[model samples]
Target: MKKILLLLTLAICSWSVLHAQDDTFKKYRENAAGKLKKAENDTTNRLWKKGATLSLTVNQGSLTNWAAGGDKFSLSIAGAFSGFANYRKDRHRWDNTMELAYGYVNTTSLGGRKSDDRIDLTSKYGYQIGKSLYASALMNLRTQMANGYLYTDTSDIFVSKFFAPAYLILSPGLDYIPNDEFSLFVSPITARWVFVLDDSLANVGSYGVDTGKHVNTEYGAYLTANWNKKVTENIVFKSRLDLFSNYKHNPKNIDVYWTNMLTMKVNKYLSANVSLDMIYDDDIRVFENKNTGVLGPRLQIKQVIGVGFTAVF
Candidate 1:
C-alpha cells in the first residue's frame, strides 16, 4: 500500500508542473501580442501625414533726399501658402498639395503693380505594380487668383486675369518612385483643357485658345519629374519639370513647364527663398517687339527672390 501511494504522489506532481508551464507560456504570448499591436498602430500614424506652411515677405524703402536715385517711397508685399497631405501604406499612396501666392509692389516710377500671382493644386494616387513601379493617376490645375498686367510707360497692358488662362490636366500613368525625394511619371494618354473664363481675354485669345472661344481641349502624352532634397544643413532645393505632346497637332512640338525653388533657413521663423519658372507652349504666340520681331513661340521666364517670415508644419 505504501508503494502504491508513492507512485500516485509522483504522478500528481508531474501533472501540476506541466499545468504551471502552460500558464506561464500563455501570459508571455499575450504580452508579445499587445506589444506588436502598439507598434503597428504607431506605423500607421507615421504613414499618413499632413503639413502646411505660410510665408510673408515685405520690402520697403524711404528716400528723403537720397542720391543713388532709386524708386522713392517703395513698398512691396508677398505672401505664399503651401499645404500637403501624403499617405503611404502597403503598396498604396495618395499625395495632394495646394499652393497659393500673391504679391504687389508700389513705387514712384511703377506706381502699383502685381509682382506675382498663382494658384496650383495637385492630387496623385498610386497602386504599386512592382517594387518601384506603380499604376497612377494624377490631376492638376494651374491658374491665377487675380488680375495680372504688364507695366509700360504708355499703358498697363492686361496680360492675365483670374481663370483667364487656366490649365487643367488629368493623366493616368506609370509612376517610378524609388524613394521619397524623387518621382517620375509618364502617360501615353492625357487630357488637358485650357479655360478662358474672362470674356475680354477670350475675345483676344491670349493664351492658346481660339478667338472668342471659352475652352480648348487636347489629348496628349504627358511626362513629369519631381525632385526635392536638403542640399545642406540649412538649404533645401526642389524642382519639377513637365512635358506634353498633343496627339492631334504637331506631336514633335512639345510644351514644357519647369520650376525650381531654393530655400535657405536662417532660423525657425526666418528664411530666404529664390524661385525660377519657365514655360514653352507652341500654341501661344508671343512677340518681343512687333515692329522688328516675328510673331512666334517664345520662351517665357520669371524669377523671384525674397526674405520672409515662414512657418512650417
Candidate 2:
C-alpha cells in the first residue's frame, strides 16, 4: 500500500507540470497574435509612408610571408544610404529623397584616395492640375563631403573639398507624372547657385567660380527626367537625367547630369548593386594631366559595383 501510494503521487506531479507548460505556451501564442494584429491596424491607419536603408561594404587584401611578390596590405571601405518619405492624400503628394555615399581606398603605391563620393537630396511637391499634369515646386542639392585630389608624382593636389562645389537648384514647374515610376518636370523659371565654400578652392576659382568670388548665380530653364522600375523579382533599376540651359549666358550649351543604378536583392538584408554616373558642365574645366597647364571641359564618368547590406521599414 505504501509503494502504490508513492507511485500515484509521482504520476500526479508529472501531470500537473505538463498542464502548466501547456497553459504557458497558449498564453504566449495569444500575446503574439494580439501584437501582430495591433501592428497591422497601425499600418493601415498611418498617413505617411517612410523608409530608410543603409549599407556598408569592405574589402581587404593582405600579403604574408610568401615566395612571390604582391602588394602590401590594401584596404577599402564604402558606405551608402538611401531613404524616402512620401505623403499622399486627396490628389496631393509630396515626395522627398536623400542619397549619400562615400568611399576610400588605400594601397602601398597610392597611399590613400577617395574612390567614390556623392551627396544628393531632392524634394518635390505637387498638386493635381490635369489627368497627368501637376503643378510642382522642386528643390535639389548636390555636393560632396570629402577632399578630392589630383594624384601625381610630386604629390597630391586638392581639387575639391566639402561643399566647395555645391549646386543648389530651385524651380516652380509643371510635372508630367504619368505613373508611379516616371516623372518629367519642366521649368522656364529656375534659379541655380554654385558655391565654392572652401577658402583655398574659392581663392583659386575652382568649379567655375570666378577668382575671389565665393558664389556664382545663374538664371536658367531646367528639365529633369527620372525613371524607376523593377525589372524582375530580384532586380531593380533607376535612372535620372538633368538638363539646364542658362538664359543669361550661352543658352545653347546645356549642362547635363545623368545617373543610373541597378540593384539585385539576395534577401532582406543582402544585395548586389551597380551604379553609373556622368556629368558635363561647360564652365567647369578639368585637365587630363595635372602637370599640364591647359584646362577644358571634360566629360566625367564613374562606375561602381559591390555586394551590399540593406534594410527597410
Candidate 3:
C-alpha cells in the first residue's frame, strides 16, 4: 500500500512540472510576438519623420515696357520643376533639394528668344536646439545659362554666346517654430559671396561701360514667415512672406519678394494652384542691365495659374 501511494505522488508531481513548463513556453512565445509588433510600430512611426515632394509648372507671362531698355510687350512661356527630399532621425536632420527650369520668350518688337536654363542644388544640416528652435547650416549652388539681351535704340538684340554663372552661399541660422503649422525664421546676419564664372563678361560693354569683376561682399539679413492651414481634409492654403536687406552695402540693392499660393485637391492625383508674386527691387535695373546698356528703376508683378499631379509610392 505504501509503494502505491509513493508512485501516485510521483505521478502527480510529474504532471504539475509538465504543466508549468507548457505555461512558461506559451508566455515566452507571447512575449516575443509582442516585442516584434512593437518594433514594427516603431519603424512605421519613424516613417512620418521623413517626407518628400515634387512639383512641376508651366508658366506664361508678359513684360510690359517700363524701363529705359526693354520691349513694349513681351510674352514668356516657361516650364519649371523642383523636388525636395528630407529625413530626420531624433535630433539630427538632413535635407537636399534640386530645381531645373527652362523657357522661351517672344517680344513683339524684339522677336523670339530662348530662355536660359538653370539648375540649383541645396543641402542642409540641422540640430535641434530646443522644443521650438533649431540651428541649421545651409549650402546652395546654382548654375545657369546666360541668355540676356542688349537693347539699342533701333533694335532689340539677343546675346550671341552663352555663359554659365555659378555661385555658392553658406549660412548658419536659427529657425523658430511657434506651432505645427506656423513658423518664423530669421537669419539676423550672414555673409554672401556671388561668383562669376568668366571675368571676360565683366569687361563686356553690354553690362556697363565701367562694369568689371568686383568681389562683392555683403552683410545681409533675411526673415521669412510661413503659414499653412487645412480648409478641409484635402484642401490647403499656404502663404509665405520673405524680406531681405543688405545693411552694409548699397541701399539701392535691397529687395523684398513675397508670394501667396493656394492649392485645391481635385482628386488623389491632381491639384490646382494659383500663385501671385510681388517683387520690389531697389536695383531691378542692375539685373536687367547686367549684360545690357539699358538702365532704369523697375517693378514687377507676376500671376500664375496651373494644375499639377503627384504620385506616391
Off by over 4 Å in 2: 1-46, 64-70, 289-293
Better of 1 and 2 by TM-score: 1
> Per-residue lDDT of 190-214 in model 2, one digit per residue for the tens?
9999999988888888877889898
Q: lDDT of all the models against the reference?
A: 0.91, 0.90, 0.63
Q: Between candidates 1 and 3, name the one with more favorable lDDT.
A: 1
Error of 2 at 244 (Å): 1.2
Error of 2 at 97 (Å): 0.6
In terms of lDDT, the best-performing candidate is: 1
Q: Could you tell me which residue pairs clash in candidate 2?
A: none
The residue-by-residue lDDT of candidate 3 on 1-313, one tens digit each, is 9999999999999999999999999999999999999999897676444444444444444555656665556666655555666666788766676766565767777577665355767776778899988897766665565465555668655532333234455667887766668866678676655444345554553222235763345567766576878889877787766665777756446566565667777877677777676766553344345566576556556667767664433
The residue ranges of model 3 lying beyond 4 angstroms of the native Cα positions read 1-80, 103-122, 141-167, 198-200, 204-210, 251-253, 281-294, 308-313
How well is each residue in 98-217 modelled by candidate 1, as lDDT tens digits?
989999989997788888888999999999999999999999999998887765568777767888889999999999999889999999999999998988888988777889998999
TM-score of 2: 0.82
Error of 3 at 154 (Å): 6.5
Judging by TM-score against the true structure, name the best candidate. Answer: 1
